[model samples]
Target: MPLLDASRDLIAAAARRVMARCDELARVSAAQSGIERVYLSPEHARVNRLAAEWMREVGMTTRQDAAGNQLGRVGDPASAALMLGSHLDTVPDAGRYDGIVGVLMALEVVRLLRDATLPFAIEVVAFSDEEGTRFGKALLGSSAVAGAWDPGWWSLTDAEGTSLREAFLEFGLDPGRIGEAARQPDELVGYLEAHIEQGPELDERGESLAVVSSIASARRFQLIVEGEARHAGGTPYDRRRDALLGASEAALAVERICRAEHHIIGTVGQLEAYPGAVNVVPGEARLSLDLRGEFDGARDSVWSAISAELDAIMGRRGLRWTAREVHSAPAVFCAPLLQDAVREGIRSTVATTEDPAVIFSRAGHDGMAIGAVTGVGMLFLRNPDGISHHPDESVSEGDVARGIQSLAETVLQLAADR
Candidate 1:
């Protein structure tokens, strides 16, 4: 748990490199107007080339894996590799930090230690896709590495109706060779990811960085309410069975119930009312519910309550309702020793009266999938105003410096353990 032995100058240099690289990658967007580097897109290839070039400059051997993941390795291939880096993919108009920062930070870590190779190997992985923006399934890159790639995903299509397999082929990668991306059990020491906090927690606590305890379990649901579509002017309020109105009540109940609980979040991210007509009442209303929590029990408990509330709401309005499960993922906890290494890394970078803050992420990460294969650890850098997935999302140079140092120190810390 002792502070990282690296000098301040090295940390500063690494920070500068990460900041410059982030700006450089921001320009390679799929959209000319804003950032939109989705999976298997041309922009994705452009960014990977840039990242791979930087990795090579830092004295690492680089390759673009079959899954389109850009990987850079330091030390002998025979050695057990400590996997570092984050996803390179982004949501449309995403902030410069989110996943890209982590990839750059990992490459910087290798650069900081260029003079002395660690006892084991270090690999920086620019995961091809984690946002799921194009294919609507997140962690596609990490899933392949974790040996969890679903063959069903091959048929998944983008907004343009192009299949995932077709996109892979067009991107100069063989979809049939995706299995080649999976890392064997003996190939890794562990996985470490350094990323922007994407929330106000660290900033609110007046800290630049913190260790993550767990990634939240999440569930997505589609709720639909059905009612008779009648003439709006003729159907009196008292006699009307309005599907939209019933759906609105259910949404409000979701917010109220979640707000009353601790660590549980429920959001209706999308909503639609059917039967397109200015005068006719909506015959059906459909809404998307995304619920997440630190624990599966808490998440499911809140979901069941929401479902019951929906039942009551529909019953009162004489509307028929149904709930469909869309997506579900269980929580992933950080390994205890990895948590200690990151905590010590934080300790090495800043002055803290209390213990270094540890947070449970409500937002998901590629770590969730990677954790299925090996131990995983995460370090979170502070983000101003907790903004992400937007052009205005920002992070400070000073925070980046601290984050780089913390991540480098974490590698050393874990190295000592082995």
Candidate 2:
């Protein structure tokens, strides 16, 4: 019942190729040392070309969609297809395997199953953007596919003040044709994505992979606390209203409330004080609030309590406070049938009779956007340190090999039913 002893030669060979391709893709980055390929940039184009090349080698016809999503297909476009993919874009100073691994592993799955005529077509997708590095909004590529493109996104700009419409034109893509990316419900089967766990669950369980039960609903807010600024030496303790002190207490309240719950997580990831000086009492403070949970109702409930705590803190300190929501995404539960296939794949590939771990993903993904269209299923590869979105993100080759086999098996298991 050893987890890794069941590795096969064919799967290992395919995984070696997949990892080698990841190394090649990592070289196509905007950053010099670390990875930073964003949406519609030259690095993005280079990586797409590389992916198309690999797809062709596996008997897939390739093209980039209107929204710049790179795609490879094994059957006629007229036929319904099962989408398997992950984003190609990366955050600043990102690790190699966060999104790239899923795309590469999908190609390998196709390479393994190329000789067969499955019940449905298979499309390997390398989404153009997911990290939202250049554009402040995430899932630009997948959103287009899900037909969730907002007209307002065109007005969004990058750090350089270039509008999204301008960036699309610069990339030689027609923004007017973006609607061509949407896939209708009748046009395909469900989606399957193999990604790094981006957490410590699988590693902690000493397992190679796990099935995702649900993706967490998330909401973000910008909280601002305002008070009068005065000289630290001149302002009397009883007379002064320090915005920073109020913000500090609110952040602590968030942590305390979230920790008391089962799956809720609240983070004040960023904080800043105006006129940051040793002698000046802080007049204003701004903090980013990111909250997530397995259920939206529970998440919103916790947020309400946190808001009340912020209000109490502001009132006690004689400060005015305001909160504005920046983003919101509802929870998405995996289809029970797809979840079964994923579980079956894990058991067969790892040769383990032990029930595999099933966990909810607290981090958002392209699936959150894509789930608006079709059912979404995910397989999580073990990330030993539970680290992601950084240069240190990692997945062992052995685990990746297991991932390829499991993914291939998931497809085969579904095909058998079809």
Candidate 3:
């Protein structure tokens, strides 16, 4: 039977309901962190509870783990389980769709399976803290499930000095028991996630879905520039040792270098000057650099060139600087077999409609983190403006419906596989 024909109205209705709940969910997420700042706030706990309720309403069993990940399941538990889910957290002031869409889509998949009487079991998960909005550590929930959670991570704190372990405990979860969250490697038959493009690639290409091949490798660092602070009026431009100026020049140089190397992408996302005074020449500047590329070697080479440029620029300007590497993760390629399933699923959905979906994703997602442990596949709905991670990010209702149908069909195909 044709999948869309069987569940089109239900899919469309679910998307509408998901959109309707966006404001409530967003507000709740904002409230959770007590910051009212980001989408991944303490309210995410509320969102998880609501998700569990919704799963129950749809006749699925649900549970919450030590890391606060909410899991809703249907089908037989004895067989290898197919997991479909996405993170529930978001960056501060994040748009409603980023991680929410994936979670909602997973729920819709469960609803569809219940309606269709599919033979295999499906698990829907709302992973916590994928955004790292409060804790500055991304993929913590997924890492826990992958058996990669570090007990030492309990010492990690947020900007406010609240440890993640503390937060987990306060939320009625035991951090020491996080190891129990890990899934047995053989238990997972496959995994899938749906997410916003979070970039211009899909809208620019006019595609409805993207079959992600690999996630870009990423490296983040802090560049600290130090120079003597002096009176702005007393110091001549030639003689002044201005850290801010040197840092700005180095940042621009980094941008120029990355632009020159088409494969590498770099951003100086944050910059701060110490002892700010309108009349003082700034003596200390800290710049945070986020660099990414599809290839590890290419990313390393870009970093090498950027380091060289920073050294040359600082030395010529008589400034002392330190570069501290903060975070690094290698690029992740989707399993070829799972990729094929995604392509087939998308093609099945397209066969039912005149307009086919595009297939590609450039943004990092929980799928990438989970792919490290199990077979992971992803599907993306069309975003007219290709905007994400902000209030302005959006996806059309038609596109969402198509993605749901495609995902449901894909889940069934994978579930039926021997």
Candidate 4:
């Protein structure tokens, strides 16, 4: 593979452009996701238009699907396409690089490819609603493309009771036409995404690149523990069935289970106690648990352990309880051929032994969603501190350049395949 000077310049320019728009985009994302105090707001339509314009500026033809996904095409429509891009939406108050990096890199790829002749078409996508912060549904755009959209999904409402369908209408997107976003199996020959590691794996190990093997299996659930409400001053410790205590016990069980299992992570991210007043005895508690493991059986074992612990705690405390499974996605392995290509891409970049390749990723990405339908590969640029999704997230300019080099090489190599 030959390195092109113009491609390097284009990638550098794209990164600079992204950095300049960081503050403005962050504010827009925060407001649209209604992330100040909630999960996310339905602002896919708003961001899609902005992304379309950016795509056009880079010489790519753009379009918005009914699912609110935006695609910018480079190369000929008749050729097999290699799609590169990421989601545009952010987590509530999320730092800029979470999803934006991949999207920008895709645009950069288009800009670079347009300057040269390529065998395959390249479609840069800005997928909508991958965070599930707004509609409680993750991977909305990718799911549509994968033919996984459920009619009932559009009927789901946000915390404020705004239906997703209505939100689409407000954005001038026809929810009824969402099915049109589905791609023919042959349309996408391969996919590549450049994303921040969003975890300590790369930084902690002093590795600059991560060729991901698989995405972790995740199970999300809500536990509701109910107990009698009483005045704090009037209730005796031994006589009261404290829901908070049971909830605490359950949380600890979750921690212990995760600690006992390798490559498994469990978090009780959200917890609410009724009568949160200091003087009142809590009557109800709601907690959300997110358990993940690299293997399916490991995840199931951890869930079982957690459930047993929750049951024992509830029984011992004499508290009524309920548990509901909210979402579960089995671990997904990246296609081996694509993985090998990514590895080759990494090796193609000249680097010191200090910048060796590593393989691990704890954070979920749009690539995981796309992998379900098509071959997908990812590249992780080094983050010295492994910090991401925050304002302080940083990556060296050199690493960015190397990553783009690797990406362009990989795309060119893949495009050469008949």
Model 1 lDDT per residue over 1-418, tens place: 4445677787787788888888888888888888889999988988888888988998999999889999999998789999999988889878888898999989888887766657889999999889889998888999999988899999999999999999999999998899999987789889999988878898898878889999999998888899989999998998888889898898899999999989999999778888958898989999989999999999999988988888888899999999888678899999999999999888977776678889988889989999988899999988888888899888888899888888888998888777
lDDT of each: 0.89, 0.90, 0.77, 0.77
Better of 2 and 4 by lDDT: 2
**Which residue segments of model 2 deviate by more than 4 Å?**
1-7
Better of 1 and 3 by lDDT: 1
On TM-score, who's better, 1 or 4?
A: 1
TM-score of 4: 0.93
lDDT of 3 at 286: 95
Count backbone overlaps in model 1. Answer: 0
Model 2: weakest 10-residue lDDT segment is: 1-10
1-418, model 2: which lDDT tens digit per residue?
1122233788889889988988888888898899999998999989988889989999999899999999999976677889999999999999999999999999999988887668899999999888888987888999999999998899989999999999999999998999999988888788999999988988988888999999999998999999988999999999999999999999999999999998999999889998889999999999989999999999999999998888898999999999998778899999888899888888878866688889899888888988888889999999988999988899999999989888888888888767
Q: Which candidate gets the maximum lDDT versus the true structure?
A: 2
TM-score of every model versus the real structure: 0.96, 0.96, 0.93, 0.93
Worst 10-residue lDDT window, candidate 4: 34-43
Error of 3 at 63 (Å): 1.0
Model 4 per-residue lDDT tens digits across residues 4-82: 4454566677667656554445556445453221222344555666788888998888888878788988778798788
